[model samples]
Target: MKVKAILIGAIGIILLFGILLTPKLKTVLKTTPSDEFIQLMYDGDVRELTQEQLKQYKDDINQELIKLKHRQSFEKIYLSLGKIASLEEGYEDSNNYLLNVISPGSHTNKMIDLKVYETLAVNYIAMGDIEKGYFYFNEANNVAYQLQDAELVASFYQLFSETLLNYTNHTNFPIYLLGEAVELTNDYYKKIQLRKQLASVYELNGFFDLALTEFIRALDMSVEKGYVDLEIKILGRLSLSYYSNQRYQDSIEVINRYFELSSDDPDLFYVSLWLHNHYYLYGYESVQEQLKSLEEATSNLSIEQKHQLSIFIDFNQVFFLHSDGQYEECERYIRKLEKLKTKTTISELTGLLIDKMKLDLDYDRGDQGIDYIKEYRKLLSDLQLTNDSVERKRLIIDNVLHHLLELGDYETVYQYTADLQKPVTQEITIINSIMNMIQNSSDSHYLAKNNITSMLLKLGSYVLSTLAGVGLTYGAYRYNSYFKMLKRKAKESTIFDPLTKTLTKEALYETLELEIELGQNELYYFLLIDVNDLSSYNESFGYLAGNKVLIEISNLLKIYFPNAYISRHYGQHFIVVIKKPNEEELLQLITSLINEISNNEKISAKRPITCCIGVSKGYLTNTLDIDEQIKLATKKLQISKQRGTGSCTL
Candidate 1:
């Protein structure tokens, strides 16, 4: 029996040694130098990969794929990096690979799903399949919502809106989508960004008044967030919007403010562009100084920044030079711009080509300008890009009209107006017909009376038949608007602590409940704060001063946890629930609150203030009532206060 037991023990030891050694042996044999793959990604040098290197990399990736244990997680990182590398490699099959990977049920990570969708949407957009692109963009947005990531949701919406703005069939979609984005995000910076995008969309749609409103909102939010860079950008956009709406004085004021804030930015290209455009509109001479400043600043920019800066500079310079009668210089700049055009993004290229066409027309180079216009049309057709090219088209038509008018070609001008797509020309025709009909009328009073009588007759019957319909329509519209307003108000209130215009106890409770429901699943302490000297302060300094101390404490809470929810439980007591507070953060917050209250000038004679905090940490069970838990914490707090003037008990 002893020999049999010895044999079993020896076999068990051998089996244990084999189990421990197997994985290490396999790892040593199979390991390859992943550094090259990692280096290519980190250095962004995939474009320089040799064909042999690419083949080796593909083979290695295939081998890695076979060996991957965590397929779902591994594929996410692989495909994301692969997509970037594929784009750099200029591979024709890259888009097909991306599309195949973005199929349903392929990715489980919400962030991965968002990236995949975005890649696919961009690819589709580049392919001129806007409808499919938008569908994928919307799918990505839904995933962002499911993930409950407000920042991601806002970003997707911005991209989706911009894409829609570039399409003629769905211009209005962007306006509404941006409005929704602004509503979803609570961060001041993101709100301003969405507002700016919305303002741009509104301006593109010819809703100047609405555009102004959104731009002003963006400016205010930028100021509130203390975002100096964004504030300057918004100011520039505001100035542009005002100029577009013909509010020249407002434009000047806004542009002057932009100059003030953006004086330090090395590349003031946008400012220079705005100045040149507005100068042409209002015939202002001050733009020369701005132009000089811009030229000085452009010397320090990096190549990429210079590339962007030069586009705007050239765009404005084309017209500025023409207006100054430097046609030769303008032609030189146009040629320089054409060389740089190939490196430009699609949007920049479109704007530049259109501007070139306009400059050619302005210089009486009509035949040459028509050639440029044909090129512009081909580019637009090829890219399927659309926007308010109405103004540019109108400028072209106006030049044609003026040229024909000067040559006594009235018949041709009339025919041209009939063929033009400009709303202004259509309005002019309508107004001329109305004027002619009035002039031909034999009795003006009789015509006026007939019009009034006819309008009244139609209005009476229309009102009688549609009064209920109008009321119902108005009721439905107001109801939806009101519902949205209430939802927004509720969200705003949730972030506010009602007692001191900070976070409230109810808000804290709701936040905790949400965290618990979301499976944070961690053990943390809840602190019950009781004001020990509040009664003394109330008696000596009056409740107003006492309230001031409370407000000071609340302000300190805000400083400690700008995103934390704080709540007042009673007249002199507050509560703070932290996920897990370290000794440093908790003690620092308490010390700051006490010091602020004790030293507050509004506290009358620098009244002494003190507080006690009780903390408890354990897995909270459903059996323990919240009020009972608070009472237990308060008892511990009272004991701490007895031990010292300002103390914490745990």
Candidate 2:
């Protein structure tokens, strides 16, 4: 019922946005008058061109250039020549040729001159002369404004922005231009696309906060415009933005939302990626089964799409083969991928993964893996690597750590760990920090609560996915704190906690990961409840009284969320994972849970028992984004705690 309402609501939103965008969508869809033909003379389409079409265009433009040169030389001829030249990466040639149209002795066509400036800007940016590119872009904008050609200006802005992207991620200038373009054009479809570009630029620059805002706004506009295809595209890009940033959990969460909205045959390659994240987070043990299933499901993809999808498929093969003791097969696939890596424009994230696989599979040659560390780091410096590249790098470093530890090279290992890499050792350190902070219920501890919660959620994700090998490296931990954690883990090995009688933290995450891996097509609501002021209860009543409050809340949780998975997440924090078809039903349930906890006589002491609840919901996306959702809920709980006695937050 909740999912149905959401679908209906989503449909309504699309209809409303479409109605709002009718005028603007019409504008872009409508053909330009002869006056605008001058603009069309430059470039007819703003969309990505296929190789065949580009080849044909290059041929056609060259023929036109020859014809114009034979007859009478004209500004359009130079523009045509320049356009063809630029396509061949002949930036300098294109620049010199384009300058012919604007040269003192040549034609004085204002529109042609504006186009020349825009083209030159694109060329210069592609050539790495960003400052020069901006200068020409400004010139083009000025000419566009003088002509009062909003459509022309908009197209130019979009073109230059796309061009600049290849050159740099510092997108402030393009952002300014795109903002101007969006404001100038009433073309809602174009506006959404432009906003997506703007958001992407923000993301590439690591301004995820800004990127998220723009992405959400664009998503709303896409839905409002009734552009389901566009909405799907927006969601896909937004997920990539998150994935490229190493917010895999968030990436999975967005993908789940994508699943809820996307069609049956949504983008095949990203679907594969979504599956990959699903398995990585959830079904760590079911690689062969999942891989075989995905291969069958995606067999219908085009050869090109399959080529792209192979990265995920092949990587899993290497991983699964290694695990299954098919060492020769695993080594063969790894070698094949190493060759594949050279031929493909693999993203840094994928590159790191390939290298990390090498480290994992070739533990005997760990030092060789360390040698490649500089190259990966160079990728980081070049910004080709995603933010999560650091984590991937850490995994490689861990492999190196194992090799060095065997050689008894403690000094070198110490040197390597001294840097900012959050290797397995660092994860242990973080766990230590969180455990320590949990005991201290002071103001500062609560202040640290939000960060700790996020890290713990992340740690929970690593517990299965990437944590396997890291688990081995933990043998090097000589600290007593490490042993204490091991003892605690040993004692709390069951699926349910011994006290308060709910799913243990590890078990809750495991269940969430598995649910995501199963790719359940149901809306899920994650509610993170932090029992407020536990120390106060302990202080006022007694330790047993505090225990009774926790126990009673746990029981009430089962009664209230009968169909939900309830878990105790260590120290005053409890997690409730439930599926409700409609959002209203979830909200009502939250309200009831809050009231029940506050009113139950068994739970109440000097004052009614209170808890801060943070909630997040989406259809089960196979994203194993449960961790991200939990993180969000935890953040909301912290916000509630910070906001002072709030019943709940979303």
Q: Pick the candidate with the highest lDDT.
A: 2
Query: Judged by TM-score, which candidate is best?
Result: 2
Question: Model 1: runs farther than 4 Å from truth?
Answer: 1-67, 82-115, 141-152, 165-169, 277-318, 324-650
Model 1, span 534-567: residue lDDT tens: 8876897666567767887777767776655567
Worst 10 residues of 2 by lDDT: 474-483
* Candidate 2 per-residue lDDT over residues 51-109, each given as its tens digit: 56656665665665554423334566667567657766789999988888887767467
Give the runs in model 2 whose Cα sits over 4 Å from its true position.
1-73, 241-268, 280-283, 286-288, 296-311, 317-332, 339-650
- How many pairs of residues collide in each model? 5, 8
TM value for model 1: 0.43
TM-score, candidate number 2: 0.47
Local lDDT at 200 for model 1: 77
